[model samples]
Target: MECCAFCPTESRELYKCPKCDRLYCSLKCYRNEKHWICSESFYKDQVKEHKPELMENEPQPEDSSSKNFNPEMFEDYMKTFKKDTRSEKEKNPQIRVRADEDILFDSDDEPDYVRVVAEKSLEEFEKIDMNDLDRKLTMAGLGGLTDNDEQLEYLYSQLNDEEKKMFNRLADNLQYDEMGLMNSVFGKNLPKKK
Candidate 1:
């Protein structure tokens, strides 16, 4: 069953608005609802006005070639182009209007689902102690010997299955390239070469 974009009601029958491409349950629901799709007649009239030449099958004058076109024809073309552009801008006024007043702000009454999910993910991420490894590495650095193999093993063990796979792939690529795995792991600045 398809749900109406505007309303909470769900229906098996989906009626798509020709103008805005929004779906509705019934004609009555659509008629009563305040949606951008309701302005279909206005758009239809615009379509009619913009393509005036398409509406009629008038034959071009044999004497009036493209090279010999009058200045009036050029003026008419420019006027038509300007009118069409203006009509398009008028149709989507919200997009063109820079003022905050002209913009249609979403109601704060409804909570955004995607935003809620993102916030939850961020909260979870914040709870994780990412600096724990760095602290451990810093303490280990106090010792003269920085055990790179042990550090790599520890880091690799801490990673999830997907992350471990990616790490392994990177290690494989580094091995195939005949460069120090340390250079690939810790970047060029590190003096360690293996």
Candidate 2:
């Protein structure tokens, strides 16, 4: 049997989330899944508007001309943004907003299953943040290094032998032709488009 989405060690009896229909071993995983997927999935399904098909006679993928050619018909896709008259609750929210009834303030000594699952997710996020933070802090001292070679030297010295091999592979592309990339951005210092 497939393990629960949240708990891998548990496989006995799993409950399915009503919104997205994801399986969970414990009620806590089911609860946590609510904040992450359930609530959004429920409302999203309810309010989803069916869009009409684009075209019946659309060109096939294998046709080369259809792929390369741009339609000359349209000046712009839209003249103005359509005004969304729906209230805040009707619209897709930026962040997940749980209904008041969904939230349970259970006050027991030990952390509940939902709290454990949420904490685990939080710890993983924090670990990613710290690693990125460390890299930024190290890069912040780059100006103090005299040149690009010196900066590379500092970075290489900081790496282990295993990481040094990866670093060398990354640096391999440093000498490749950059003319196309440079042209795309600077555009051969082209004349201004009127």
Candidate 3:
């Protein structure tokens, strides 16, 4: 383990802050340290020194440009902005609520019928079985398929005992036909088998 930069006496057991590269022993120490506090004179001085360009490039309000801006263009811009904001908020609903509060604080108070329906849907989703090919394709994502046989062999070798058994079963069922196996695993049509 690395030693803490601030306090050499302490072990670097905590994660280093990506922004400052400072090692903290714990979240409490990170928050309580004089360097961490926003009100600290040294902290303010460091921020100003390190990010002088940011202060210099602060956006100035459009003085006369806003007056001359077309109403139609402004409407269109507002529409686009609203749509993007709505989508973003939908994706992260917790942002609209207070960070300290729970979003599903009353989840326990939900109706028994609603709870049953939700549980049933979750159970159905969990029951879906994935074949070996399906598993590989899912893991591959947009990378499509591996071209290197050695990489594929290495990946196969890395599988645990149970996974190895599954792979062997899949290969046996596939009859060692690479093209057919690829197609079956990815649920795509195979090219003409040579």
Please give each candidate's TM-score.
0.20, 0.23, 0.21
**lDDT of prediction 3:** 0.59
**Which candidate leads in TM-score?**
2
How many clashes (backbone N, Cα, C below 3 Å) per candidate?
0, 0, 0
Which is the better candidate, 1 or 3, if ranked by lDDT?
Answer: 1
Error of 3 at 78 (Å): 43
Tell me which of candidates 2 and 3 scores higher on TM-score. 2
Q: Give the alpha carbon lDDT tens digit for every residue of 1-194 in model 1.
A: 88997788888888887767888776666664366335445454676799766647534444454644433343553443323335435777656665544444455433576678779999988887657656765788642224778766776788999998887887777785675555475466865422
- Clashes in model 3: which pairs? none
RMSD after Cα superposition, model 3? 23.4
Ranking of predictions according to lDDT: 1, 3, 2
The TM-score ranking, best first, is 2, 3, 1
TM-score between model 1 and native = 0.20
Candidate 2 segments whose C-alpha is farther than 4 A from its true place: 1-142, 173-194
lDDT for position 128 in model 3: 68
lDDT of 1 at 183: 46
Q: Candidate 1: what lDDT?
A: 0.63
Candidate 2 TM-score over all chains jointly: 0.23
lDDT of 2 by residue, 1-194 (tens): 66888766566567777756777777567656334446444544555534224333433443345444433322321212244578555664554556753323344333577688788999988778655665676688635554689887887899999998876765554533343343466676865322
